[model samples]
Target chain A: MPNKNLVGIFDSDEKMLHAAQKAKDLGLSASDAYTPFPIHGIDEILELKPSILPKVCFFGGATGLLTAFTLQYWVHAVYWPMNIGGKSFTAYPAMVPICFELTVLFAGVSTFFAFLFLRGMHPFKTSPFWGLQTENNKFALVFDLESESKAEKVSSLLNQEGALEIREIIE
Target chain B: MTTATASSEILRPPLVEGGKTYGQITDDICAPMEKRPPLGWFVAFTVAGLALLWGVIMVTDLIWTGVGTWGLNKTVSWGFAITDFVFWVGIGHAGTLISAILLLFRQKWRTAINRSAEAMTIFAVMCAGLNPLLHMGRIWRGLYWLFPYYPNTMGPLFVNFRSPLLWDVFAVSTYLTISLLFWYMGLLPDLATAAAHAKGAIRRFIFRTLSLGWSGSARTWRNHEKASLLLAGLATPLVLSVHTVVSMDFACAIVPGWHSTIFPPFFVAGAIFSGFAMVLTLLTLSREFLGFKDYITLKHIDAMAKVTLLTSMIVSMAYLTETLIGWYSANTFERFYFINAATGPYRYCYWTQMLCNVVAPQFFWFKKFRRSPVVAFIISIFINIGMWLERFNIIVIGLHRDFLTSSWTMYHPTYVDWGLLIGLFGLFFTCFLLFSRSLPMIAMSEIKHVLSSEKHGEKQHA
Candidate 1:
C-alpha cells in the first residue's frame, strides 16, 4: 500500500476549528494544520505544547543586560579611567540608558531568530502544501493515512464538517 | 428594537470596511504591487530622486571640503545637522508607538496602518542616522569610533560609556535594529500571500526568500503570535527609552534652555506630536493615491487625530512649564534664555513652534475637523513645521547667545544646510515610493484575523 496524506480544506477558520475538534474526538491524528492567520483555540484542539519563545526572550534579555553592564564597567572603570567632570569612574548612573537599550536589542533580536529556528523557517524553503492557498483564504488540516480504508473515513469526516474540498497526496 | 439588539447596534463598527472577504483583502493590498507603477508614483519618485541626488552632492562636498561647508561657528557649533537628527528621530517614535504600543493594547484598528507606519519608522531612522554621520566631518573615521569594540589601535581607547552622545549611538542603532526585526516579522505572512499570487518566477522568488518560506502552519502561527506579543512588550519601553536618551543628550548638558528636569517627557510628547502629524500627512496622501480609503477610514483618521491632540496638549504644557521654571529659578541665564526665545532674534522660530505645535492641533477638539482629512493633513503639515522649528529654537537659540557678550553671535544657515534638509526629504520620499510600489502596504493577514474575530464576535452576540 502507498503512503498517503488526507488534506481537508475549509474556507473559514471557524469551520476548520470545528473539524479539527471533531477529528480529535474521532481518534484521527492530524499531522499538521494551516491557516491564513492564527486561529484561537486551534492549538488546544490539536493538543500542541505551549511555545517556548517567551522563555528564550527572557534569557536573551538577561544575557544582554549582563553583557552591557560588564562592557560599560570594564571600559570606564578599569581600561582607561579618565576623570573629566569629577564623577566616579564607574558612573553606573550614566550607563543606565545603554544598558536598557542593549537589553531590548538582545531580547528582540534573539527571540526573532529563536522563533524562526523553532519553526524550521529559512530562506528558499518551500511549503509542501503551496498549491492549497493556505497562506491566503483557505484553512487546511492534513492527516497521514496508514491504511487504504482510512482515506474514505477521513474524507467522510471532512464532508460531514462541510469542507470546501478534500484531496489525497502520496508522499 | 429590543435592548440587546439596540446595544449590539451601538457596538463598535467593523474595522475592515466594504465587507471584504479574506481573499479580497489580500487582492486589494497586493494589487498595487502587482500592477504597473502609476503615473503619480513615477512623477513623485523622480522628484524625490532628484532631491536625494542633491543631498548626496551636499554630503560629498561636506566630506571633501570639511564641516566649513555648513554654517557652524564658535558659538553655534551644532546647527541644522543636530536639529534635523533630533527631528527625524522624533518622527520615528510614532511608528513604534502605532506598531508596538497599539498592538499591546489590542487596538484592532492598528492592523490597517501599522505596516506602513513601521516602514516609516525604519526610513525616518535612516534619514536621522545620516545627519550625525554628516556632522562627523570625517565620517569614515568617526563612524568606527562610536562603537566600543576591543583590540583596536590608538591605545585601544574605548568610547566613554557614560556620555549621553555615546548612549545615543547605542539607543538609535538598537532602535533601528529592533524596529527592522518587528517590521520584517509582521511582513512574513503577507509576503507569503504575495508570493502565492505573484505571476512571475523572479517576483515569486524574491518574496519567497524575503518571507523565509512561511507555511502559515498552526504551530508556526502559535509561536509567531507569541513572539510578536513579546516583541511588542519589549518595544514599548524601548521606544520610550530611545527618545529619553535623545533628550538626555541635551538634558545632561549644561545649556540654559536644553537643561531641564522635564526634557525627557517634553521631548517624548513633542516627538509623538510631530510623529502623528507626519503619519497623518503620509496616510492622507497614501489613501488618496493608493486607493486605501476603505481600509484607512475616517475612523482611523479620527483616532490618529485624537492622539495628535493629546500629545500636542502635553507638549504645550511642557512649554508652559519650561517658561515657568525659567522664571522661578531666578537664574539670570535661564530667565534671559526664555525671554530671548520669545522676543529675541530667533523669536519667529519660537512663535512658529508655538502656533504649529500648540495652537494648530487645538482644532482637533471639534469633531468635524477631526474627521476632515483635509483639515487633518493641513494641521499635520503645520505640526511637522512647528516641531522642526521647535528643535531649531532649542538648539540654535540656546547656543547662539550663551554666557559671554563676546560669544553672542547670530548664526545663519548657508545654502548647503538647506539643500541637505531638502535632500533628506528626497531620500525619505524616494524610499517610501519604492516601498509602496514593491511591497504590500497593508498587513493582509492581520486584517483577515480582524475580520474573522469580528465575525466570531457577531456570532457570540447573536
Candidate 2:
C-alpha cells in the first residue's frame, strides 16, 4: 500500500521541478501545486492531465445556441404567432441575426457565471486565501504533510535548494 | 561572436535603456506644456468650464420649466437635440474603436492616442446621453426608458420591440456599459503601474483599490489579456449594433429622405469617418502638447490619415449612392429632398460638407500631407465641422421642406441652439484637458510591444 500523505517542497522552480521529476522517477505520489504565477511545466510535474475547461466551454456554447434557437422559435413560431406583411409567422431567416447574438450572449454569460461559481466568488467578500505577499512578491507551494520525520526531510531539501523563507502552514 | 553578421542581425539593435534618456523623452513630449503659460492655460480652461456650467444651468432650468424653451416646433421636433445626439454619439465611436478594435487587430500605432480617444468616448457618450433626457420634457420619466416602462404602467412598460428608438435605448446603454468596462479594464494594469509609484497613503489606497490588487504577474497578465480580448470582441459587435440601431431610427421612418436602405452603412461609415477625424484632431494637439512624439509617431499619424481617407471615401460613396438611388426611386418627394440638399437654402452646409468630407480627405494621398500633423489637424477639424453639418442637413433640411409647400418655411437655428452647440465644445475640451493632465496619454504596454516587435523585424532585416 502507498502512503498519499507525503509531500515535498523546493526553493526555486528548477529545483522543485527537478525533485518532482526525480520523485516520479522513483515512483512517489505527487498531488498538486500552488504558485503565484502558473509555472509552465508544473502540471507535468504533478502528473495532472490538461484541464476540461475547453470541453466545458464547447458544451456551454452549444447549449446556449440551442436555447437561443428554441426560445426564439417558441415565441415567434409556435405560440400566438401573428401574420404581419404576408410573411411567415415563424420568420426563421430573420431570426438568424438575433439568434446568433443571443447565442453568443448566453455562452459568454454562462461561462463567466460558471467560472465565478467554480472559483467560489461572491459579492461583498474577501478571497479565501489572504496572503499579503500573494498581492505582490512571493510565490507559495503547498504540499500535504505526512509523518513528522518526512516533514523534516522535506524542510531540509527545500532549504538545500536556496529557499529564502519557509514555514509550516497547518490548516 | 563572429565579426561578419547577417544584414538582419546587424540592423537589429539591442534594447539598451540608455539609448534615449528620460530627460530627452520628457523634453520632447512635454514641450507643449512648457511653452505655454500656465496662467493662460488655467484661465482658458476656467472659461470653458464656466461655459459648460452655463449649459448645465440651462439644462436644469429646462428640467424645471419644460422642453418648450427650445424652438422645437411639432414638425421640427428633433432639430438641434437629435442632431447633437447623433453628433455626440458619432464622436463616441473613435475612442473605443481605436482602443479596443485596434488593440484586437494588434495595431501598434494606437498606443499614443488610445488613452485620449477612450476618454473622448466616455465624455462624448456622457454628452450624448444628456440630450435625449433633455429632449424628453419630463426628465423624471427618464428611468422609464431603462425599464421599458411606458405612459400607463406603474412598473416598467413592455419595451416596443419594433421601434428603432426603443432599440436605440437598449443598444446605446449596452454600448456605454461595455465601453466603460472595456476602458476601465485596460486602465487597471496602468493604474497599478501608476499606483506603484505613489508615495502617499491616500493615493496608494485609492490606486490599489482601483487596480484590484494587480501586480503585473504573468498569471494576471494572461487573465487580463484574455478579459481584454473578450471585451474587445464583445464591444466590436456592440459598437456596430449601436450605430446600426441609430441609423434604424431613420431607416425605420416613413419619410422619403429618412426611409432608405443605405442609411445604416452610410451612418456607420460617417460615424467612423467623423470619429476618426475628431480623434486625429485631438491626438495631434495632444502629442504636440504632451511631447509624446516617440509614442505617437509619424507612423500613427499616417495610419490615421489613411483611415480618415478610407472612411471619407466610404461616406462620399454613400452620399453618391443615396443621390443616385433617390433619382432612380423616381419618387418625386425623394428627388425634391436630394435636390434641396444640393441647391436648397442650406446649400452652403451641403457644399461645405462635400468639400470637407469628400475633397479634403484627398490630400491624405500625399504622404507629406498625411505625415504633417498640422495638415491632419486642419483636415480633422474640417471633418468634425462637416459631420455636424451633415447631421444638420439630414435633420433640419430634410424635414423643413415638408410636402405641403404652404408649410415649407426656412428653418434656422435659434440662439439657444447656438449656445448649446458652443457649450458642447466646452464640455468636450474640459474633460479632454483633464485627461491629458492626469493619465498617461499613451498605452505603455502596447508601445512596448510595438518596440519589441519592430526590434524583431529589425533583427531579421539587418
Q: What pairs collide in candidate 1? A: none
Point out where model 1 deviates above 4 Å.
A1-3, B1-9, B458-462
Off by over 4 Å in 2: A1-171, B1-44, B149-152, B155-157, B455-462
Question: How far in Å is the alpha carbon of B387 misplaced in model 2?
Answer: 0.4
Measured with C-alpha atoms, the lDDT of residue B309 in candidate 1 is 97
B145-179, model 2: which lDDT tens digit per residue? 54332253654333333456756765676567667
Where does model 2 sit among the CAPRI classes?
A: incorrect
Q: On a 0 to 1 TM-score scale, where does candidate 1 land against the true structure?
A: 0.97
User: Which candidate leads the pack in lDDT?
Assistant: 1
Lowest-lDDT window of 10 residues in candidate 1 chain B?
B453-462
Winning model by TM-score: 1
lDDT of 1 by residue, A1-171 (tens): 666789999998888888888888888867778889888888888778999999999999999999999999887888778886798988788778888999999999999999999988999787667878998899999888987777788899999999999987665
Alpha carbon deviation, residue B428, candidate 2 (Å) = 2.6
Model no. 1, DockQ:
0.77
